[model samples]
Target chain A: MVTETSLSPIATFHSARRGRYEVAHQGVLALGEGTIVVEPGHNFEQGLQGLKGFDRLWLVYLFHLNQTEDAPPVMVKPPRFEHKVGVFATRSPHRPNPIGITPARLLHVAGRMLTVAQADLLDQTPIVDIKPYLPFCDAFPEAAVGWGGLAPTPYRLLWSEGARERVAEIASAHDLRLDHYAEVQLQLDPTDTSRKRIRATEQGFALDFREWSLHYEVRGEAQEVWIEQVTERPEFPGPSSLK
Target chain B: MVTETSLSPIATFHSARRGRYEVAHQGVLALGEGTIVVEPGHNFEQGLQGLKGFDRLWLVYLFHLNQTEDAPPVMVKPPRFEHKVGVFATRSPHRPNPIGITPARLLHVAGRMLTVAQADLLDQTPIVDIKPYLPFCDAFPEAAVGWGGLAPTPYRLLWSEGARERVAEIASAHDLRLDHYAEVQLQLDPTDTSRKRIRATEQGFALDFREWSLHYEVRGEAQEVWIEQVTERPEFPGPSSLK
Candidate 1:
C-alpha cells in the first residue's frame, strides 16, 4: 500500500527582470517570453532524459509569491467583473495550497537552465516538477471558458520624463507594477480615488500623482482611455489651520 | 524574498476498489468515472468555494503509489514498445517527483465531499492540491504527441473458474488490476517472458504463472493470442541434494 509522503521543490527560477502582471494573461500570452534559469535541479539531469523530442513542457511550480495563510476572504473581487466571485471559480492567487501550473514552450534545455518561450512566474518561482506535454491526452479545443472572457479595456499610458521618475520611485517603495500600476488603475476607475488624484477637466479628466498630473480623454463609446499629457502638479501651501 | 518551502498532501483519496491502469489512458478513458471521498482535506472547505459554476476541475494529486525513492532503473521498458524507453518519456509510475495532474469532471460539491465524474487515482491516493481548468487559456488541439501512438494489439483473455480465483488472489496481494495485468502482458508479448512465464509447447506456447500454467496459441499474422486452458503446474520431486 502506498503511504503519505512530503515534497520539496527541486529547483527555483531566476529571470532577468520582473514583469508587471502577476498572473499569465489568458487570451494574449499563455506563457510569457522570458528565459528563466533553474538551479540545483535534479529534474535537469536524469528526469529530463527523453524531453529533447518535445517542444513544450508543463511547469509544475508552487506559488511562492503567495505562500502565506493571510489571504483575502473567499469571495475575491476580480478586476474585470463588477461583483465578487468565489475563490475556486476565479484563478485568484490567494489559494489554500498556492500551487501554480503553466504550459511553457521549450526553447532550449542546457544543463540545469531551461530557456522557455514564455514563463508566468515571479523572478524566483519554486518549481516542483516539469513534465513533457502529452498533447494527444491533454487537448480540448472546444472546452468552455467560464467567467474568463472579461479583458480589461485598453488604456494608453503616457508619461513625462519627470512623471516616469516619480512613478518609478513611488512604485519601488511599495514594490508595485511600474508599467501597469497606473495604467490598470486608471482603466478600471479613472475617477482616481487612489492617492486622491483625479480631477474633472473641460476636456476629460486629470489624475494628479505626487508631483505629476496625467491628463486623459475617456472615450466611453470606444472603451478606451487616451492619455494626452503628463504635467507637473503645482505645489500648494499648508492647511488653513496653519493660517 | 520567497525562500524554499515544503508541501504535504492535504487530502487522501478513498475508493471502493483500485483499477488496472496506472496512468490515465489517452485514446481510451481520460479519467475513470468514480465518486471519490476526500476528508479533513485541508483545502476542501476553502478551495472548493466556487467549483459549482464549472463542470470540470483539475485535480493536482500526488502519485502516492510511487512514494518510495527506491525506484526501478531509469531505463523503463514500456509495455507497448519492445525496446527500453527513457523514464521521462513514458507516463510510468516511477517518476522523479511522482506528481500526477488530471482534469476531472466535478459532479457535486456537498460540503467537503467532491463527487467527480472522472478520476484515475488509485485507492488512498494522496491529493496535493486542486486547480480549475481554464479552457480558453489551456486549449491546444493541434499540438503533436511525440512518441505517443503505440497501441497494444488486441488479444482475447480467457480464464477458467480456478484461474479466475487464483488471479484475483494474487492481484489482491499486490493491490493491482488483474484483468489489465493479464491483458497487457498478453498484448505486448504473449510469449510471456515478462514474468518469466513462457514455456515451449508443441502447439504454440505455455505460460507458467506461479502454480498456474496458461496454455495459449500465438497466431503471428493475426497478432493475437488464444488461450486454450489454464491448469495447475505439476509439483516435481525435490533435487537429489535436498533429498
Candidate 2:
C-alpha cells in the first residue's frame, strides 16, 4: 500500500450559476454562467455596482469539480506546481469539500450579461459567492514566494492565429488594454519560468493559458503558444488550445 | 479632498486577543476568550478531529468584538497590515460580515482542548467552525504579493528574564509550545503591522508551523516562551505606526 490517509467532511458550500445557486453539503457550492445577473436586485444592487468598478473580483467558489461520495484528496497538484508537487503544496482542484476561489476580473455588466475577465470556469461554472477586491485589504505585499517561484516569470503573451482577434475584440468592448506585458502579468504562470524562452522558440509561441496565467514559448521568430486552460483538470485542453 | 475613491467596505480591529464567544446574527459569529465551549454536539467531534491533522485550519468565527447596532465596516485594517493601508486591503478583525477566519495549526486534540499553532486568537477565543487545510485546494500558490512586502519583518526574541521558564511550564501542562515564534507572531502585536513585519522577516513562519515547519523552528536557537494571559492586550507604548 502507498500508505494513504483518509479525509473527513468540514463544511458545505452553497453555490449556483447566473440564475442558479445551491449549497450542496459542506463547502460544496454550485455555480454556472447563469449564476450572476446584471439586473439590480434589492439585496444584490450594492454588491453588483461594487463589483463593476474593479477589473477583477475574488470568487470564493466551491470546488465542485473535486466533490466525491467518498473522502476527497487532502493534497493536490496545484497548477503552479506543474504536476510535480504534493496536493497540499499545490492548488489542485481535487480536495475535501472542493471549495475553490479565484480572482477573476469584471469585463462588463450589461443588463444580464455580466461579462467577466478571463475565467477558467465553463459556460456554467457554479459560483458560490463573490467579493470585491479591496486592493488595501486583499493584497499581501511582503508574502513569501513558495514553489510558485517555479512558475514562469516576466509574463509575456504571443497570441495564436485567432486568439489575438478574440482578445482584441474583448479588449475593445471593455475599453481595457489586453496586449501589454503588464496586462498579461495579471494572469500569472504557476511555473516561474521565463516566457521569452518558451514563446520565442521556433514552435510558434508555445503558450499555456490557464484560468489564471497565460504562458507562451517562442522559437526563432515564431511564438510557441500554450494557453493553460482554467478548468480543474490541468490535463484537459482548453477551448482556445484546440485551435 | 484627496479625491479618493470609495471602492469597498472599511473596518477597524480593536485588538488581537482572547475575550468571549457568542452568536450574533443569523450567520455572524463572535469570538472571545471567556466563552470557550459551544455545545458543538457529538456529531462535530469527527469533523473536528479531521481538522486537527492539518498544519493550518480556517476558523470561521464570529467577530464578537464588534457588537453594536451600527453597520460593520466596509473596509478593515487587517491585523497583519498594521494601520497604514485601507480596511479593504488588510485582514483586520473588523468587517461588514463581522466574520473572521484565522489560519491556525493543530498542536493536539485532547477532548476539546485543541492546542493550535498560528492562533492569533486570544485565550478562550471562541471557535465557531474549524476546517482543515486541503493544500491541494486552499493554497493560492500564484496569488499576488501586495503590501506584505512593505510590512515590517518580525524580530526574534532573546528572552531577557524568566520568560523562558513561564513558557516551558505552560507548554508542558497544556502540551503547547508557547515560546515558539508562531505564538509571538500572533500575540506580540495584535496589530496588523507587527504581524506583517514578523511574517515577512520569517517568511510567514507561522504559516509554516502547521506543516512540520514548527518542529524545525523549535529545534533552532529561538527559545520558547509561555503566554502569561490571553485576555488582556499587551501595551506597545509607541506612536502607532502605519504598516
- Measured against the true structure, the TM-scores of the candidates, in listed sequence, are 0.69, 0.37
Worst 10 residues of 1 chain A by lDDT: A23-32
* Cα RMSD of predicted structure 1: 7.1
Task: Give the Cα error of residue A196 in candidate 1, in Å.
Answer: 11
Give the DockQ (2 decimals) of all models.
Answer: 0.31, 0.04
- Each model's TM-score for chain A is 0.63, 0.47
Name the TM-score of candidate 1: 0.69
Give the DockQ (C-alpha) for candidate 1: 0.31
lDDT of 1 by residue, B8-93 (tens): 65556665335434334432243345554444634446555666656567777776656667544555666546666556556666
Model 2 C-alpha lDDT per residue in residues B1-243, reported as the tens digit of each score: 011111111111222332222121111111222212323333333333333334544444444555342544433344343344433233445544344555444445544345544444444333434444443333433444344322233333444245456545655675445344343453323223333332322422322222112211221223332222221123333334211
Best by lDDT: 1
Q: For this target, which candidate reaches the highest TM-score against the unseen true structure?
A: 1
Candidate 1, superposed: residue stretches over 4 Å from native = A1-5, A16-32, A41-43, A70-75, A82-86, A144-177, A180-243, B1-4, B16-31, B41-43, B70-90, B147-177, B180-243
lDDT of 1: 0.59
